[model samples]
Structure formats: C-alpha cells, structure tokens
Target: MRSCWRSAVATRSSSISRPRPIGDARWRRAELGAQPDLTAYRLFHGDAEGAPGLAIDRYAEVVVVHADSAAVLERWLPEIREDLRDFASAYVKVHPRRASRLTGQDMQQAAPAAPLWGLGVHDVEAIEGGVRYLVRPDAGLSVGLFLDMRDVRAWLRGNARGLSVLNLFAYTCSFGVSASLGGARRVLNLDLSRAYLEWGKHNYRLNRLTLDERDFVYGDAFDWLGRFARRGERFDLVIVDPPSFSSSPFSVTRDYPRLAEAAARVVAPTGILLAATNHAGTSDERFEAWLQNGLTRAGRHGQLAQRWHEPSADFPLAPGRTHPYLKVRALVLD
Candidate 1:
C-alpha cells in the first residue's frame, strides 16, 4: 500500500495542473461579455498566472495555448480542450527552448498543436488598448503578436497626437498602428522583412487606418537610422525595440546599448524615446543602464518620464520582482 501511494504521488507530481486566474474576471466579463474579448485579452500567462510552463491566450472567441514544453501541453491538451469548448477556435504552439541544441530539437519536434476542437484556424483579431491588430496562431516563432507590449501600445495611443512617430525594428508595426490611431501626423514603421511589413499593412486595413506606401518601410532599421540622421529627419516619438538576437546584417544582436545610440539620434529635440527589450538573463537595472548609456553616446540627455509597465492586469509578475523578464523605458530627450 505504501508503494502504491508513492506511485500515485509520483503520477500527480508529473501531471500538469490548471493555472489560477488573474485577479477578478468581473471587469473583463463586463467589458467583453461572457467570453473575454480576446481582441483585448483572456487566458493565462506562464509563471505569472500560476502555470509555470503553459499559457493560454484568447483572440476574440479563438484560443491559443502556448507552452514552454510541448510535453506538458500534450499531457494536458485534453483537459484544456474540454475546458475551452465554448471558444470558436483553438490552437497551440511550442515555444522553442534554447537551453541547448538537444533542447531546441525537443521543442521543434514537440507534439504539434492542432485544433484540438472547434474550427481550427490560423488567423485571428486581437485588440490592444482599443486598437485592433491581427494575430496568427502557430506562425513561425512569434505567432504574430507580442502580447506583453500591450502597455507600450496603450501609452502611444494616449500621447501620439499630432506627432511624427518612428517605430524602429517594428515587427508587425503595432506601435505604428497605435500612433496612427492616436492621431499622429505621420507614422513610419521600419523592419527587415517585406512580408511582415505587408502584413502590417493588412493590420492597418483591418483597423480602417489609411496607409501610404512610404509608411511601410521594408529595410534595415539601423541603416535607415543613419540615413535619417544624415537627412535631418526627426520624429517626435521614436521607439527602439529589438529582438534579443538576429542574423540579419542590419539588426543588432544582444548589443542593445549600441542600438539605443542609433535610436536616440532621430528623436526630435523635445521628443520622446522608448527603448525596450525582452532579452532574458539581463536584469532590469542593466537594461535601463544600457539605454542610459546609449543616450549618452548620442550626446543627448534623457529624463526618465516613466518606465512603462504591463497595463493588462492579466500579466502578473512574481511578487516584488524588479527585473521581471521584460524591460521598457520611456525617456524624454532634452
């Protein structure tokens, strides 16, 4: 009997459990109705929401269950499916683990997440701060949108009026969309991928925002920054948010301090600059220090206006955590 009890305990320990909800859902339900307006938000965030290796995000009536380990997702897929029966569609993706080559393979070969139930679809609409953006489930790597940047978009919506905004390293141009929606005079989105820029244009159309050919720039942001500086081009607001690593010739990899210097050059004399990164291992203080150093390199002094935090209550960080995996600093150039 002791052996049997031990076996049962081991099994329980191996199995994945449901994650806790983020605070009260009453406000979310009231704003979005019974089903969370995934266009805005719904579901769990890993570590933050009590599910360490798993996260479930809702896009309107569709659900996207993202897991750190595919095995954990596979083990609990059935329970997840049944629980999300009311959702119009459901999808899943395995986040690539970069611990080692073998771990990377494990993530790549991890059980494919198909539509467990409901009409399995790839594309969906999600809202951030009242602005609509398109999200594609199971897309290579990113799955379309970075949900954590929700507050950055919110900040832009509130402050982009009559200003010219430059979004450097703009993935799908989410910041540009926010600036446009917030009545920016001109918003330029610069990225390395033409495909992503085209998709960004689709997002503009989805939100009924007008688009000009020049608004979507498909080139290296770093190269363009130099040219913009030489041409005396300046923007009231400049955002520099680069991926942790990139092989692209023009992209900055792990060297965000250098990227920040390039970013500050184009900020208008009395403009705002937002530099952010999601690089793991770098503490919050270190990241902020890098941005500060970058400003100094550009011969510009920056006053910290506000360090942007996640606006969505759903993204909870560990209690009293200072460097919570993501860092965004908003500074005003002097």
Candidate 2:
C-alpha cells in the first residue's frame, strides 16, 4: 500500500471522499463476510488506508471511527456512515487536541466522542482468527480489543500448547486468552489493572475455559518479574508487551536493554520469548538492538527465532518501512 499521509489537503478524485474505499468495498465486504469468527477489522485505515484523519473499525455489527483531525473528519463522517448504513450503528471519536501543549488539567479532558447513527450498544461479541472476545462500544478511549495484535495472538495460540506461558502487561489478558485457547498447559496473566484482569476472566468464560485465581494475577509486571526470577519460577513461553509508560509503583523501562534483561530472567533455559512495543517511534532495527542488548546483559546466547509484525489485511503498511508504528520481535533463549 502507498503512504496515506497527505497533509490536510483533499484527495484528487481519490477514495478519501468516501471514507471506506469504494474500489475495495466488495473485497472488504467479502473478507468480513467470509470470516465470521474474525469480525473486528479496519473498515478503513485513515491516513494510511485512504481516509485521512479517520480510522474506521467494525465490531461485529457496530462501527467505530477514531479521528485525529475533527475538522477534517467531521465532513466525511456522515457520508461515510450513510454509504454503509446496512448494519447496526456508527460512532466517531475525536483525537485529543495538541496534547503536547495542553496543561495537566486540560490533558484530562479527552477528545469528544458521540454516536453518529444507528443503535448504540455496549455489549457486543466478536471473533478474531476464530477466537472469541468481547467489545464495549462505549469505550471511546478504546474499543476493548487491540486489533493490531491479531497476528501476535495467533502466534501465541500455536506455540503455547503444552508450555507454561507468562503474559506480562496483559491488557484484558487477550494474549493469555489466546494462549489458553491454543492449549497452553499453564497460563498466567499479570497486569496492573484488576478490572482488566476480571474482564479477562469474563473472556475466558466466554470461551468455556477454566479460570484459576492463581492464574489471573494482579501486580506490577516488573516487580513480579523480580520475584519470579528469584523464586526460580520459569515459563516456557514468556510474552512481554508493555505500554509506552507505566505509573505508580511500577515504572516501565525506557531502557530497552534493561527490559530485555529483566524479561529473560523469567524465561526457562530452553524457552521462547516474544516482546513487543506499540510505540510508533521505535523502529524494528532499534527494537531488535534492544532485544539483542538484553540478551547480552543476561548472558544468554539466544537466537532471533522469529520477528513479528502486523499481518492482517486491515492493518496494511507502506513499502520500505522498518516497522509500521507497532513492532514485535521474538527470540529463542539458548
């Protein structure tokens, strides 16, 4: 796909005016229809797919749009909704304005959000790669599921069976859910938020999977990593997906090499580790270097088993780019 970053200017007879690409409408529709299990997808990737300033997503019957530029997004929201109003409802989320310049109080006020049309519902069920997950349409800040991690979830399901898995920074335990769905013998989800972990339990329930309180842990990932390292607790597959910045007692490492070192300590001698960062600024090469440095610090001569990236059709990328905002790298510790 070509770069969709055109500066606020109008598309010259391009699909931008239509929001969801008319050219790919049939293909998009067919893709969504064919995959009943994987319902959530990028109906239109704003700025990158075609519609600048707007990112249209589907959660089963509901459609969610997140736009960075309300000024530009406002004009197309209606037409976009009308052209494809066959389904349920529609919603739009405005990007928080120039956060860099906003004061702390001002920062607290988030971007505006409202339902454009259709029935606005919260309780919605959806699937991805045949895996069931919940979606809360009212979560203007988030749509419950991070669709970009679709490939990562699939990878966990395939590689985690029969292995003890540890998912750190597990938001809503999506990775853990996928691991259990894939048959992981022992899966542990650790996160700072208890509410999300509880939500994760709900997800487990949806899949008819058993849940142990011991398995769903609540704490700082870094702190627990230290405890697990000292206790000689090891996992065959360790997943470390951290947010950009963490607050309170748990401060995430800006030092990538240090993070890698901490992550390796919890991995079994013959284990596989998958670490990812969603920070768009971090290139794949830079992230890999951090991973390599972590291995060096840990004194573990690990092989770069596999490198991962966004693979679903919805999260398309431009050519000649190292990483598409979200970067993931996997390794085998020897």
Candidate 3:
C-alpha cells in the first residue's frame, strides 16, 4: 500500500519536462485516497475559517457537501460537482450564515454547535477506539468520536482485555466503549459534565452495552482520582485524554501533573498508564518529564512502554508552528 501510494504520487512528477516542476494538488488527493482503506472515509480541503467553508464526506453511495462560502456556492459549485461526479453519489449540505448565529456570553461560547450545517442527520458510524458507533456529529464540541485518536484506541483495545480500566477526562466515553469492546471486565469513566456523561451513556447504548454495569462518575477527575487512591482502588489500564483548557475548575497545565501523580497511586503494580496530551506546544521530552516526575513524586515506579502516534498518515502539525499535540505514551509498572 505504501509503494502503491508513492507510485501514484510519483507518476505525476517529471524531472525531464521542465527545469522546475510544479506539484499538482490532485496528486496529493490521490495519495490520500490510495491509503489502506477509503470506504466511508472522505477528504475535504477548504478553509473552515476563511472564505471557502466547503466540506465533503462520503456516506455509503452519497457524497455530502456543505457550501457556506458565497463565492464557492455561486461560482465553484458547478466545477466541484463535475469533478466529484465519479465519486459514487454527491449531494450538498448547506450551512447558511443566518441559520448558524450563536449568541452567548463570550466568543468561544457564542460559537455554533459542532454539527454546523453538514448533513444534520444523526447516527453516522464513525470509527474510533476499535468501536463503530452511531454518533451524532452535531451534538457537542466533540463529534461523538475523535478520529485523531484512532491508532491509540486500536492499541488499547488489543491490549486491555480483562483489565480493570480507568478512563479519565473521558469525552463521550469512546475509550470506555473501545475497552468494553476489548473485553474489559470493569470500566470507569470520570468527567465533570453530566451532560456529556449522559451522551457517553447514549454512545454505549448505541453499541448495545449497559452503562449501569460500568461506573460513570460525575465529578472533577482529579478529585475522583484522589478518592480512588484513598479507597485503595487500583486499575490495570488508565487512559488520560484531556482538553487543552476547560472552565470546569481544572486547568490542564495547572492540573495535569497533579492528575498524573494521582494516577500513579491508583495504578496496579503491573498496570499500564497512558498519559495523552493534545497540547501541541509541549515537546515529547517535556511531556515525558511531566509524567515521570509526577510518578516519582507520588512514590510510584514504572518503566516506559511506548509512545503512540496518530494512526493516520496525514500529519496535522506544520513544522514551523508550535503544536503541543504529543502522542499517548504507555508506561508499565511491571
């Protein structure tokens, strides 16, 4: 597959034709499409914040497009439609400006809900954490799935069966879903938002799993971890995927190291701990230091297992930009 993708890209490049050859964007698209699998996976390359607010996703035989840019809707739609004619079936998902006016206390709070006009229908099967879920993309800031964590999820699912799992900073409980699918006997999800916990329960329901069996604790994850330590509760597997910053009385930078310390106390002797961060500005070494120091301060000893990367080939960070999104590193105490 790698060679095929390389060849597909190289076929368009020529050293003999001119002194300097211009790279074609179509070749990039072809490379993206010629990956391991392209079913139910599509690509869209338009500015989300700029003039062109165009999005395209393939669902079954249909290709859904959302044209929020006026110029693209008026001028480029015909060309885009013609180019996409060979791609199964195509349809437009409109995101009119007036239909998406969000008003709240602040700009961040005023932003419209995530589903912003691209196929408002619910229950799309998005793969994450080795589980296929009927998720609603428009539900919240999260699309019910974090496709970016695909690789990390796969690794955990394969290794976590029969383990007592703890998922902190659990967003719609995708990791818990994957852990459950991976045959975990006991799973605990901790989050501050009860609404999101409810959504996580819905996601579990979508997979025909019982949430009552697994513990869903609604409280500050840091506080819960401290309580877990006091109670001498231990887990075999722990996944920490927290947001960059939250108003939930817990700031990541201020709270992450403390969280790591708490994690070390609750982790079993032979357990595996995953401390994942999406802060792209922090280097890999710094992230490792933070975790290692926290564990040491908490009087826990663990060996570094592995540093996981994004499963997809498309790297999200530009080299020049400071991206703190480091991969999830697994630490083994055994």
RMSD of each: 7.6, 5.7, 6.9
lDDT of 1 by residue, 81-178 (tens): 54455566777666665422334445445424366567656777776656778887645456667877877787888889999999888888888888
Candidate 3's error at 198, in angstroms? 2.1
- Model 3, 1-334: lDDT tens digits are 2443354355446423632111222244565454334333334434321224554544333345556544565555654554444443344444444333433332233223333233345456544323555555334333455555666767767877899999998877878887887789888998887877887888788787767834888887778888988899899988888886565655566677887888888899889888888775677777878788788888887787887754434333333444435558899975
- Quote each prediction's TM-score: 0.83, 0.85, 0.71
The residue pairs that clash in candidate 3, if any, are 279-324, 279-325, 280-323, 280-324, 280-325, 281-323, 281-324
Q: Against the correct fold, how does model 1 do in TM-score?
A: 0.83
Score each candidate by Cα lDDT. 0.71, 0.73, 0.62
- Model 2 spans with C-alpha error above 4 angstroms: 1-29, 97-114, 245-253, 319-322
Q: Rank the candidates by lDDT, best first.
A: 2, 1, 3
Best by TM-score, which number? 2
* Preferred candidate (lDDT higher): 2 or 3: 2
In terms of lDDT, the poorest run of 10 residues in model 2 is 1-10
Best-to-worst order by TM-score is 2, 1, 3
Q: Predicted candidate 1: what Cα RMSD to the true structure?
A: 7.6
- lDDT of candidate 2 over 1-334, digit per residue (tens): 0112121112323555544452343244454546647677776665555555667777777777777766767667565754445557776666564333455444333433345777667778888888888877765456678888888888888878899999988878889899998899999999888988888888899889998999989987778989999999999989988876543533234666787888898899889888888776788778888888888888886777777777647766754445587888778998
